[model samples]
Target: MIALLLALGSSLAYGCADFLGGLGARKAHVLRTVMVAAPASLAIELLLWPVLGASFDPGAIGWGAASGVASAVAFALLYKTLALGPMNVLSPVTALVSAALPVGVGLIQGERLGTAGLLGLPLALIAVVLVSAGHGAGSSRPSRTALLLAFGAGAAIALQLVFLHQAPADSGVAPLIVGRAVSTAVTLTAAGVLRRRLGREKPAYAMSAAAGVLDSVANLLFLIAVRSGDLTVVAVITALYPVGTVLLARSVLAERIHRGQLVGLGTAAVAVSLLALTST
Candidate 1:
């Protein structure tokens, strides 16, 4: 129960972070938005390190750094997609693909879900596709570029989680700090190379900061959740973070909430329940 709650909290926070990050990236350079959002992650991780009794593990740190690169790429692509339109389309596709990859990894490692969970898996995939279709297949609303970016983002997101789990058990929050640090450095370097104007970047700073805080918190919650729960279950729940983004778009951007999206959300809920029930 605790782990489930933690994962759900992480999902909500991740949704908010991604949505805000997308908003910030709408007018600012993508890398610049990442640079601005990275600090909150660093600061929060540092402050919580000793309190959480995190130990520094070199192996974990290395994995974290690697994951950070994946994370940076994922964020940039996702925000770029969201900035264009159809938060529902990209959010579900990215999340579903991200979740499915990890589940496949688990299976290859000899982890097996029960019959119910196995059923839920394909259902989740279907939901993801439905959400992506949104209005219809022929609408051409999201554009090929946005879909391509979302696909890349989803693959990167999977890579981020896969590497993150490679961290040693004792590493605690230290790996998170390393990951955030790497992400910041890489993004900042990219921003500098692009010669993005600092003046223009300034306008998005506030949104970027808020997103940083939310993403940092989400990362922490997910780390904790994974430690206490099955990776398959935890990943599935956290992947649902995109649902929050879709809802936020409806509330904030006044975008029409599609029936397909609602159906997808419902299917996700059922899928999570099935997975969780069978796990216990």
Candidate 2:
């Protein structure tokens, strides 16, 4: 139950982070935004180190670094996909695939659940699709390249999440530290390779920094959640992030609330309830 709550909290934090990241990306390239934001996020983690306390281990550092590399690929591809076409179509597809891969991995590991929990998975997936639905130009016509990139991004996201859990449990936040460090290094390399001029454009500091803080917190919470809960359930529940994104869009962006989104919000509530009730 506590783990489910942590996962839910992570989803909300991640949703807000994504919203801010997207907004900031509007002012600059997403890769550039990430480079600045990753260091900001890493700074936050460093500040928390004395309070949170962490033990270091080779295995944890290795897995954490791998997860970071995977996350780097995921975010780069995801933002590129967003730039290419309608987020309405692409976002949901990415979310569903990202989640389903982890669920499949959990099953392969012989993780089992009750019928109620099983039922909630599909409902949560439907919620993802509906919540990610948005009104954008050319949204109705998605490009093949965008679709492929979205799928690849989803897989990378899943890989990151799954590998993060592979870090030794006693290693504490060291894994997170390593992961963030790796992300920063990778993003810097990507920036150099692409000749992206970071901070040359007017920095959307407030939104970008807020995104960094929230995303770091979300990753910490996800680590805690996966340790205590079923991987599949935690991943699926956290994938409810699109619900928060939709709500934020409706309020902040003045986006029209689609009927399907409303239904998705309600279904997400039901799915969360069922999942929480059944999770060990």
Candidate 3:
């Protein structure tokens, strides 16, 4: 139950981070926005190390580095895929795949679930797709390349989460620190490579930094949650982050909540409730 709560907290943090990051990206190139965000994330992780304690064990360093690479891949592919247009099709697909892979991995690792959890898991996945639904389906489908990139981005995100989970328990926040460092380096490199194309628009440094801080918090919460709970449950609940993003959009941007999204929000509530009951 504590794990579920922590996972829910992580989901909310992730959602808020996405909302802020999206706002930052609107003001500058994605890579430029990430340039601010990534280093900010690393700074937060560094700050956390003293409070949380960390070990430099091989499992921690290796898995952390792997997750960092996966994260960099996810960031690049997701932005590229979204740039191709028809985000309505691609966003939900990415979210579903991101959530589904971890669930599948968890189950394959022999994690058992209660009957309620069994039912809730699939419902949670459905909610992920629904909540991530955009205002419209657009006039046409995403291109095959866009679809492939979305899948790749989702897979990379799943790998990041799975790798983080595979880190040694006693490693504490070491994996997060190492992962953030690597991702920060990757973001800086990408931004440097694309400097000519990034334009001269000033990035939303504050919002981007805020996003990074919240994202680091989300990752920390997820790591703690997964350490103490079933990965299947933790991953599914965390994937509900779109709920937070949608709500933030509606509140901050005065965006309308589509029927599909409304239904999805309700479905997510039910799924969380069922999972909660099972957790107890």
Task: Find the candidate with the highest TM-score and give its number.
Answer: 3
TM-score, prediction 2: 0.94
Report lDDT per candidate: 0.78, 0.86, 0.92
Instruction: Candidate 2: list runs displaced more than 4 Å.
Output: 135-139, 196-199
Over 123-208, each residue of candidate 3 has an lDDT whose tens digit, in order, gives 99999998898876876788899999999989999999999999999999999999988988888887788789999999899999
Q: Backbone clash tally for model 3? A: 0
Give per-residue lDDT, candidate 3, residue 136: 67
lDDT for each residue of candidate 1 in 1-280, tens digit (9 for 90 to 100): 6777787898889889978988887776666677778987788888888888666678877988988999988877877777775865676677777888877776787777789878876776666566444565454468899889888889899888878777777788877989999998887777787774544545388898899999989988988887876667677777877677778988999988778888988887887677666656
On TM-score, the stronger of 1 and 2 is 2
Error of 1 at 116 (Å): 2.7
What TM-score do all the candidates reach, one by one? 0.88, 0.94, 0.98
| Model 2 C-alpha lDDT per residue in residues 97-198, reported as the tens digit of each score | 988999899889888878888888889888877787765534387889999999999999999999988888877788888999998999988889887555
Worst 10 residues of 3 by lDDT: 133-142
Residue pairs with backbone overlap in model 2: none
Instruction: In model 3, state the lDDT of residue 20.
Output: 98
